[model samples]
Target: MAFKIFHPISFIFLIFILLAPLGHAKRSTPSDKTSSAFDFIKKLKGCHKGNHTKEIHELKAYLEKFGYLKYENKSQATDDDFDDILESAVKTYQENYHIKPSGIVDDATISQMTTSRCGNPDIANGTNFMQPHGNKHESGSSNIHTVSHYTFLPGNPKWPPTKTHLTFRFSPNYPVSSVAPVARAFHKWDLATHFTFAQVGANQNSDMIIEFHRRDHGDGSPFDGPGAVIAHAFPPTDGRFHYDGDERWSIGSVAGAYDLETVAIHEIGHLLGLGHSSVGEAIMFPSISSGQVKNLHPDDIQGIRALYGR
Candidate 1:
């Protein structure tokens, strides 16, 4: 009886050993594969060497997918290991979203990563719609504004030259004090192109409508509040510009403030039918550094010119 029991027990132990590898394989799959980016980010906070590597890899892929990082060779597999490339990409992403460029995964960076954003991509190199040009830096401004790479919206759409004067109105919710900055934003674009903006009181019969909205303010493209997206504008004839009211907005150099003019210039570029550009200095770039004032880049000027001749 003892010998028979030992044989059965040994057989069960052998089966367990054979299945253990399969179980380990399942468990060894990176947590990033099974969790949301946010969950992965939560793990990255203050993570050390030999830790959170899976999350780092996931973030590198995210930035690369969104045009923040460029891979030299398409055939090369993305390294699962966290390296300098991944760290730099994280820093660049942080700056774009106005988070301090700590070069480490931080809460602010993670939050921006998880926030819902404009469907538009920050870069469009592969699309035929983009009119690629070598970057040119203009002379004599504190910051050069050149049209580096000009890309267009679907169909390369632009407002008809005949419709040179565009009318606009502030959503009742827009602070009256903010009108000056909005007008300034419009002026910056107007100087670059043939179009002009007129701010009217009525929302109807306006070429563009500007408003400050908080979560789900209708129009299907809802604001995600303060950090992720400061504002978004409709392309071409749509003429809807919305700002995330939850942002800590300021006109000038205020610590931890989102520069209103800089954001407006970007959104207005969208309203004028410009898509995001890969050029870091271009106002049309999808993200902004906090409190950093931007001037138009040649890429921006060239874009508008390509659409509507200067």
Candidate 2:
């Protein structure tokens, strides 16, 4: 059964959540990946009404694709107008994410929507990828909640103890500051698990190769520049971590700014063979936000301990 340990979100920016593509058809042009809806929403003089505008239609599509909005017909045409259904969806999303639940598509909401994030799917192929480890149960009941704090990739395989000192090196093109957060990210996992990360020179052979690249950097998972995928990592025993070079990565705590350290920590969790958790507070949680300082939750500690016996 999946166990949960909830905590109030304490970040300056609540958190950025991941959005799934309705379908995966790679865009050939940069313009194709950028959404004008955010621009339009910002220009609105007041709250939009239930009139079908191109921007409203885009908003509907965005909300619906991300599990906030639900309608009777998937094939139905968008009127581009705000309605009670859309309002409710916006409010629900706001409340769930700890944003102010004003049913209007305000600047804060648009900013959150436009923020880039990791490419990992929170729910893939209609399946909750994070499955319970079948260890814990609720008190006074045999029924177990179908959830997880963290999950493994397909095989649940882990690195052997013999592979303790893993070497990593970053691409030389990125700023030196980028490497600092990555080292910190690795340190966090090192403290949690039985392994240690060794930073090596660029010419040295390494187990993990970290790079910053824009769209179509030779991987099947091409990053959409800005406002979409911020980074991704290969699972354990095969370590290739990529961050979107197009993103405005920073180490600051300024609200609405993406923190490199936060994302690196998440990608390292993936590199350590952890999957997305349904538990929102977990370091392995599928999403993150700009200006957020993420620490390993107890659930995250429990998960790594379960996997590596640390």
Candidate 3:
């Protein structure tokens, strides 16, 4: 059995879910030889997402392609937290190119990562890429790292090892009308991860931003173009997720492509503290194909449970 999880969505977003080419081509995948997921992230292209021009642009394009952000911002996170963000971003990128959003960070993601990945390691790391002396910060504008999110997300202040409830909020932009589907996704967390969500407004003590856009909107990771980058987020402390509005998000089986919900599920995993699995069957795997992402695969469940020990 597929380990069914259930819950009904309380709120929903009404937006176009899918907008990419779909066709069940005879399961022929191109060969990719990259080893680690990050190395692959560096090689994705805009069409294949194999070679993004810039890291910031590549990050945004990945978010836009997937169209969902599970984490929020303005709070805190860390390099380890980036493990989740990068894994999720990589998964999203895979979904765009009709790959699986498995969170493995395989050859497909590497093939579609930023264009800069294939060149010098320093440039790929954004160390050698320097802004011109006159390229100082302008009022109302954020740079590459601070464009849409923060690179140095100070760890969570209230890093409680446990929580009350795991609330799953639908982005205000996506067309997620069916409460059942949204709730189904949330249920997966409860059953698999075991974290319950305390209605954010039940006591009404806190609120954070969980939406997406291009350029520096105050966070850190910024969007590059319409179809290049996806979106980013701050981990648990922030719980804010931003999705670039410049791409197409779809649902259901789209031939040889991935489902939007599948990508969202993987990104949500990041928001919840889980990182990439490096295993294809794991939901944490870096990528998935069209039909493969409709449901939560084994690898995904294993990763979540391992983190929270659910």
Candidate 4:
């Protein structure tokens, strides 16, 4: 056998090359990557139609990811130019979020865009589910009326009549501490809706699967780590609920941590066929603040009732 000898300097250089990737891996965490992913939107706050900046491409991608922007062809969706389609998408997004439909990216728009929200699209399959449907009478009040902001996934998918009782199971990799909070969330929905939910062992078959995932975890929808997209779920019959493992999650209100039960309630709504609600206080609202604990608002109850009957 022949052995190749390296000079001292060459050997040191080779060792550095081997260890360089390890050092980089240590520094580049999910939070850092997520921050860089969405930080560019802050720079495009004032951009409008006809303004072409490289950052506009990022804006287009953000809009596209949440179902605000669509394209007739591949070329139309790829460019950075702010065209009529882009303006229309922006206006529609503003309208859905209750922001002024100025067709320009304003401070409020940027604020809403950067807030941590669910991974599901505000508008799915050309349907703007976040828009208020109309005014509705309060459940008990004779004279008071409120706007109904609850919505459903496109085509209004729901569990069949035969499947009134559903089973849920956590992934084998799920945190053991998360079970109680998540179970409480399911109980909240159980009380509000007609459906009954039960927790099954991980090895047993289940109607729904809940798991914590980071970045791309095989599902078509990937999480953006801590700040941007916290969690997401699929509609009924598809039953995949995912939380971003990168987030600082707690059982209840913690100064800087997300409330696991609150997020669980919102995602569970999706698994039951509800969509994003325009009402900010509703459990089905797209975004949530850190350390906040939200319960099922009247609007949330109404939404579920509307989908599956009271």
Candidate 5:
């Protein structure tokens, strides 16, 4: 998890998200042990850390840095064999993710055991989009993905590039609260070593226009009421990006709500010719937040690079 300290949210988080089908790792409630590993990991303390006699301290430190983990003191340690506990934790993670659970300390297991992750976004790199839950991010991301890639990648303009840049003509029609986060998101991309080529601004002259209203715009995508889904976009020629005004567009987790800027960044990822990444933890993987990088993940970078060749 991102934070060293565990979030005090209802343990149900395990049920709603962590336990959902994501990869091969399935964390079913163990009938033998009273509580399931989901329950156990949930109580593991977002901040507590046991000794480092082994290299597990790195995992503890990562959880601490992100502030999502609760380290348990050795005394609080489970009576289960250390190996079993580790196996169970990995299994629970795998079960929750739907990854093929070997139960052995394989690369997938170690990847989960180590990488520092964002809150609900605590998925490892190589597998984000391949998982079912990860697919949630790409529900409406096709336009941006296909369009952007067709224009900028090796395939050449499979579709005609609108010589006219419509992104500049439009202005940001979204809520004012979104302006800062939108700008922040853009700036974050601009800050990336690989984002140097991308431009920012929301007005007509800008490379892209972000809107926040509902009803069918020029493009076919319609914003559902806030919450469930907040926005969507068309590929290059569309030059139009939109947000569902109903959402509370913020930079943080919303309990059950989605983040506006995060969504915007995702849509923006679409606009830029990148496709949803199959890698589970990638920004392009279709969803991310909590422990996900506020900026583009490396695989996102790779995809964009493949499209633009930079």
Candidate 6:
């Protein structure tokens, strides 16, 4: 066996190589990325109308992205001034989230805004579904009436009436480990509704496409990475369900990780024509916290039933 000897310069190069991996080992965790994205909101906690700061412009953009603050033109939306328009938008957001409609960026509002949520807009085409109607209707028993909190996308787009059975295929870019959890989500929906979902091969054409994407992966709605937007799905007939690839995803309720099944189920609701529910307990609720696992709530069931009856 031949022994290799290192010269002074070569030995120093070897030491540097050994230390390089250690120096680069400390990578930013998913939670860190998620929190960092919305850290600006924390600084703007006490901010309200008439407060002209650059951060307010970020807040306005955040609101506008989620369909709260709307402007006629691009320039108006980009302004840093928190005018009456911004105040009204804030109030609407507060009312929707069950916070006091103070029209100010309070602690509660800041907390809610920083939470990881779906990428879909709460208000679609000027229609705000975030406001819970609590519309009461008779249940199976005539005496028993239930209040509904579910709403639909603008125009209530849905699959064709005759197209009861749907085929879904995972995009080639989807994480292989995620297939099982997503399948379970489809199964749950199948059990609850009249629709049946079948998974096809990736190469085959399918009615719905499930994929993981990062920021600006097309479809007009770009994802905001980890914290702000976890995932989004299109309404029926345009079955494009996308998960933010930057999110820390997990199979179960793992700390600092979003449960894949919970998100899948929520997105599936959108794919099936159901919108966000004001009822926090519903799976279709706009936001979910890390380590939280939510099953279908009564609101979800009622919403689907209302959209497509048995």
Reference-based TM-score of each model: 0.61, 0.63, 0.46, 0.84, 0.43, 0.86
Top candidate, metric TM-score: 6
Model 5, residue 203: C-alpha shift (Å): 6.3
What is each predicted model's overall lDDT from 0 to 1? 0.64, 0.65, 0.41, 0.82, 0.41, 0.82
Compared with the true structure, what per-residue lDDT tens digits does model 6 show for residues 1-310? 0011122225555565356422322233335434546778998978888888778878888898889988887777887888899999999999888999999899999989988898888997888986766555676767554567899888889998999999999875454556888999999999999999999999999999998777798689887766678889999899999887767777777667788899999999999999898888999999998878999898899899988988
Candidate 2: residue 137 lDDT (0-100): 58
Candidate 4 residue 78 Cα shift, in angstroms, is 2.2
Instruction: Supply every candidate's count of residue pairs whose N, Cα or C atoms clash at under 3 angstroms.
Output: 9, 8, 80, 0, 58, 0
Candidate 1 Cα lDDT to native: 0.64
- Model 5 whole-model lDDT (C-alpha atoms): 0.41
* Segments of candidate 1 deviating more than 4 angstroms: 1-119, 123-147
Which residue runs does candidate 6 get wrong by more than 4 Å? Answer: 1-34, 134-146
Tell me the TM-score of model 3: 0.46
Tens-place lDDT digits, model 5, residues 1-310: 0011112324564344344322222232213122211122332332212322333444333323222233356542422233444444444455544456654444554444333221122232222222322111244655332212111212222123333222232243323334566665665555542443234554325556766565454465444342223456555544566665443333454333345566666666666654444455556544342212355676666555555443
Per-residue C-alpha lDDT of model 2 across residues 1-310, encoded as one tens digit per residue: 0001111323421231112111121222222334422345554324544645556766776565544565786544276667778777777655544568888767777665665556764444444455445565576757665444577665665777788789999765444445777899889888888888899998778989888877787988777656466789988888899887665556645344467778888888778777777566777765565556787777777777777886
**Per-residue lDDT for 62 in model 4?**
90
lDDT of 3 by residue, 103-200 (tens): 65456555555321111011112221111112133456655322211111123122256564555454444333323344455566666666764334
Judged by lDDT relative to the true structure, which candidate is superior, 2 or 5? 2
